[model samples]
Target: MTSTAPVPDPSPTATTPASAASRGARSLARLGVHVVGDGVDVVVLASQASAVDLVLLGEDGERRTGLLRARHGLWHAHVPDVSAGTRYGLRVHGEWNPAAGQLHNPDKLLLDPYARALTGEVSYVPEIFGHHVTDAAATHHGLEVRDDRDSAPFVPHGVVLPASDPVATAERLAARPRVPWSRTVIYEAHVRGFTLLHPDLPPELRGTYAGLAHPAVIEHLRRLGVTTIELLPIHAFATEHAIAARDLPNYWGYSTLSYFAPEPSYATRASRDAGAEAVVAEVRAMVDALHAAGIEVVLDVVYNHTCEGGLDGPLLSWRGLDNTGYYLHDGGTPARYADVTGTGNSLDFRRQRVVQLTLDSLRYWAGEIGVDGFRFDLAVTLGRKAGEFEPDHPFLVALASDPVLADVKLVAEPWDVGPSGWRTGEFAPPMHEWNDRYRDSVRRFWLADAKALAQGGHGTPHDLRDLATRLSGSADMFHRFDRGPTASINYVTAHDGFTLADLVTYDHKHNGANREDNRDGSDNNLSWNHGVEGRVESGSPGSELRPVRRRSIRNVLGTLLVSAGTPMLTAGDEFGRTQQGNNNAYCQDSPISWVDWERTGWQDDLLETARHLLELRHAHPVMRPTRFAYGRPRSNDPFIDLAWFGEDGAAVEGSAWHNPYRRVLQMRRAGGAAANPRSAEGVAAPVRRDLLVVVNGALNDVDVALAPSRTQGWELVWDSVWESPRERHESAVVDGAFPDAGTVVPVEPLSIRFYLSR
Candidate 1:
């Protein structure tokens, strides 16, 4: 039951027509359902509609209708008696032409573009389509035939929420945990998957917002040293019709339905049953809890397109309100959508209305919901204007200049499936991009290269130079744009690909369960299954493969944490989580997609190594440099920022960078100088400790000569080959008994080591 408050009536006053128009325009600025004064003002943007009706469904099961007054492309109606929790929807009456891109179906109840909450879930039935589906084959062949069936029964309605709702008026907002970009360690996680199988979380709270905020979850993240939590899309989304028809769900939740509302399914059943306001309140509490723990939250937002798929898609919010205005349509045939995001349609950022909607949604989430940042899914599509991506596009410029959003982090996936979509480093400053080059290089060095060596060295495509560039923040890709190393969000694996454990246990993807006949996932996984495939039980014939795979996991985790950029770890990667080689688990809602809390002895060691690696990263500033190294010492500086050395303890030069057989290199970083010459406040920065990193990707252990540097001695701090995280091995360094510059130091095969210089 919803509680209602009494609404005050408007006072009668005489006004000129000009004054009335001015007042209506001012009211138009506040779009969607808003509790104004004492009444509910419902606003809908239907520029081409001849008439609009506000349909209300009362709790008594009675339906009431009210006509809206149209002024300047906006239809608004203020119901003085209607209070908060009023259920309503819009019915725009206009020409229902399919060929000309005017999809105004009066019989179908349309959802508001700015609706804060939805009453129910969308049921995908034939009535939801604007065109009738007489023959399924004909409909699938792109035939357009108008259907007169009403869609109110299958579509969800919008609910009016009061301004003083609990979610809107929660305890005073907490200050954002403004973790610096250099120190930011992102943990990409699914709100449900992260807590679904947690043994410590209560069953009812598991897979819900409250579960993510539970003390157990917070303690784990804090111990792991992750400063930010990047959540998959939590916006109200509907399962893809095709996937749902196959009894599968879009578990990733990329198909958004409502941008402002939190996905109600992610909330506890009790909160969901209470009302939409309860769901919002629950999400608010979770954000508050995370903030209190000094952890920032970043949402993966999908604004490139919507749930309403291509030309034959359903009549959801944007498609029904203004099809051509909201989505990009083919120039030759306006009825067909220009599919850029591979989601059937691409949002037309060229339209100011669409841009305004995106801005409004972002502002609402950042200001009201208190998210610290956003990771734009298929972000290149957002920068597309005139069928090409522009760095200074109006939408991009507006976002960069927005006062409220300027301070928050902005990350982009940086590409789409459209033309010229592989934009790895083209995004402007203040907008960090996911570095695919870094991901591929790391995978090749640790997994694919090792596999090549095992296969008689026939496929060694890269060498140590490639790994060096990625380790130093891929300056070849990002430095040209004046962006520093911090602009790179480096990760070896993410939600869309293989987990850390799977990288060394599966050479190919096992996506047969996705109903695509095993042809759905990517073919180029860049993985290796060591000596055997899949899980190896204790005492099995290939039992030795397990230890090898564990070592590979440790090496990858060590490299990722020590790399010079902002590192992001997938939720379960720190604990050796695997999806049974199922790289694409986007449709599976079972254990195949959930994070298993169960662990083996080796898995515990991996987790401990990951924790220690993150702590090491935090302790040493050289590992997370803010600026790209130039390999030359400044005039006033006592040491160079960075230098690369080959196996002979000499600087790598000439053709050595391209030598495929040379897979061993050492990096010396002069951490005594500031990672960035200047601080955020334009002042001189403090000096840090110097350090050295050694990586050997060869199949056999080799003796590596220590490079000459301006340090008295070097002490071994960490080694990836160590079986246990608690093992003390400082005696291996023998401090102050310095070896000559050309003296050899034995390095384990396929291992990485870190040393602190004194």
Candidate 2:
């Protein structure tokens, strides 16, 4: 993963609380270090740890080791004179019993999972591993050999949160942007990447949380009309061993180290130097600013797995403290882990302690840090208890019942790398799930179909059928529980795959720079390069294929914003940001991974196109229905909420719906009154309008006859053929006139046209 910038220099170790050995460990509070006036209370949950040592390091390399008393499963101690900025680490002692999964290595300094901030990076080195990971051990299977080397210097230390203000936190929460699910337009962005290269921001603020909260950045989001910014993981995360070994940082932050801590690397340099308190304050301030701007902040959280990785992975925190209790193991072989997340290890939600940690962290972020919501990565893993998904899983139920998160946004990636992991619509209501089917359908229709037809072939018969279902909020998939279109978080591109720009420019992923033989990213991208590739062959005045490619982008964006479900626009996608064809540039923490803010003419045009489409969406409630239309969809009655049609403007009934060669699709959706899910106002907001959408995926121009309606004329809202979003609809609709029923609109090949009839 390329970095937004050289991660503002590693923070210096901060001061910590004084410690006193109580002989017999006891606790008044829960796990992690807690400030109590001048003193501090520290507790660690290490059921398998035979002994626990509290190590507090000083500014000049001095260390004070105190032995904590152990109770049933908790090891705790009381320390006098709580330091405002304290640095501490825990060392657990026990026998190295691999079979039973008891990997307690006293020599390894472990991070507190609940620590609010981290002071340094976890260097990828053999000294940090619990087992003997030296070069010579490679031949002798050193992973099984318990290492005796002290890992204190190489690992990061937990920074005690300075005294906090409950009032400030409460104020932030009270001011939350609480955009209801039905009206949410999520802009999936990275805190660093979003403003890393923004020309308008101060150099000091760029790439930090402060940069994302900058007015310039906020203005862009406001102009784009995204209600919520679902930032990629901001939790304290570490680079994976392999990535670190290659001298690369973990740009995406999927390998979370502290669920409670904000990644210090993402803080401004002064804040990083100021230690944990400043880091947390910066993030909180970022949230406050976003909320002030009427934008919600949703964190992309990784509770399903950790940086500890596989069975042979390092014992950083959980593995060394409570190995068996924190992670899921094979039923028969406790030594082996169940790799459901493809990240080597998965946390065991079945364990009460694990679930408690997750809930506690969530509460801290929501109640104290004041984040708007969370988007759970690999969320299917969290719902798996007895090796299968359960919609009524304890964690899911707990989230729904939690007062703090009940109304807050809760989005699920809804799948993992495990068996039967494709549980798209399996999550219960109140938690919108990522709609990959929506993504694939849109990609196939506008992009894949174009490629197929260019080669004198046709798309599948089920293509239109699947797209129709997606456009209607995936009723065939989510209606089982009556979770409406808003339950589907619609997106055509995301951080992990090709950007919207790359999707139209690259036919295949170019990840050779990742040193993985170009085999790292997914091969089934469902993308089509418009005859030209690789950044438009720079300096070409007018690439003939450029207009067509831009039209495809507009077509896709038009489909997304106008679709029934909630939409998520990937950062930089609004202006056609490119990752240079490296879809899986997870390790490229360089310019390729960061959002390129400088835009070309076409890029700027694309951004306007995005804003125009979002304007249409925000202006009309029919564009974002909270509930599926309850009326019969197949009826030709003018009053029907949703009706499907063809090029001739007649109802596309019977075999016409399954015609393989039929590339054009017309949809007539009249927005109707439904219970607006925004309950805070005590009354349902207006969600009424009428819309006519015509999509042409065919190779040749089609004379699309407008669908007839009883009550009105259609006003042209958007046309994909325009080089500029502000450009007038040339052939699609007449200038300054509304086309009535049966009017012939000359729709372009492979384009989308949206009409307003209200």
Q: Which stretches of candidate 2 lie over 4 Å from their true place?
A: 1-29, 60-72, 136-140, 458-462, 538-542, 633-638, 673-688, 729-736
What is the alpha-carbon lDDT for the whole of candidate 1? 0.82
Q: How many clashes would you count in candidate 1?
A: 0
lDDT of 2 by residue, 1-758 (tens): 01111112211222222333332223434778888666667777888666676677777763544444455577666666667677888877776877667787877899987787779888767888877776412322435578878888888899887766888877878998888887899999988888888999999999999999999999989988899999999998888776766566789999999999898888999998877788888998899999999999999999999998776767689999888889998876537788899988999999988888999899888898888889999999999988898999998899899997776888999999998999998888778899999999999888887787787675442458888888888887778676888889999999999999889889989998788889798998989897665666545843667778888888888899888888999999998888889999888878898888888888888888888888888878878877687546424323688888998989998887777778888888876544453568777554455788998888898998899765468778788888776676564434545888788878889888888774
Q: Estimate every model's Cα lDDT from 0 to 1.
A: 0.82, 0.81
Residues 489-578 of candidate 1 have per-residue lDDT tens digits of: 999999998999999999989998898888888889999999788888999889988888888998999999888889999998999899
For residue 637, model 1's alpha carbon misses the true position, in angstroms, by 2.6
TM-score of each: 0.93, 0.92
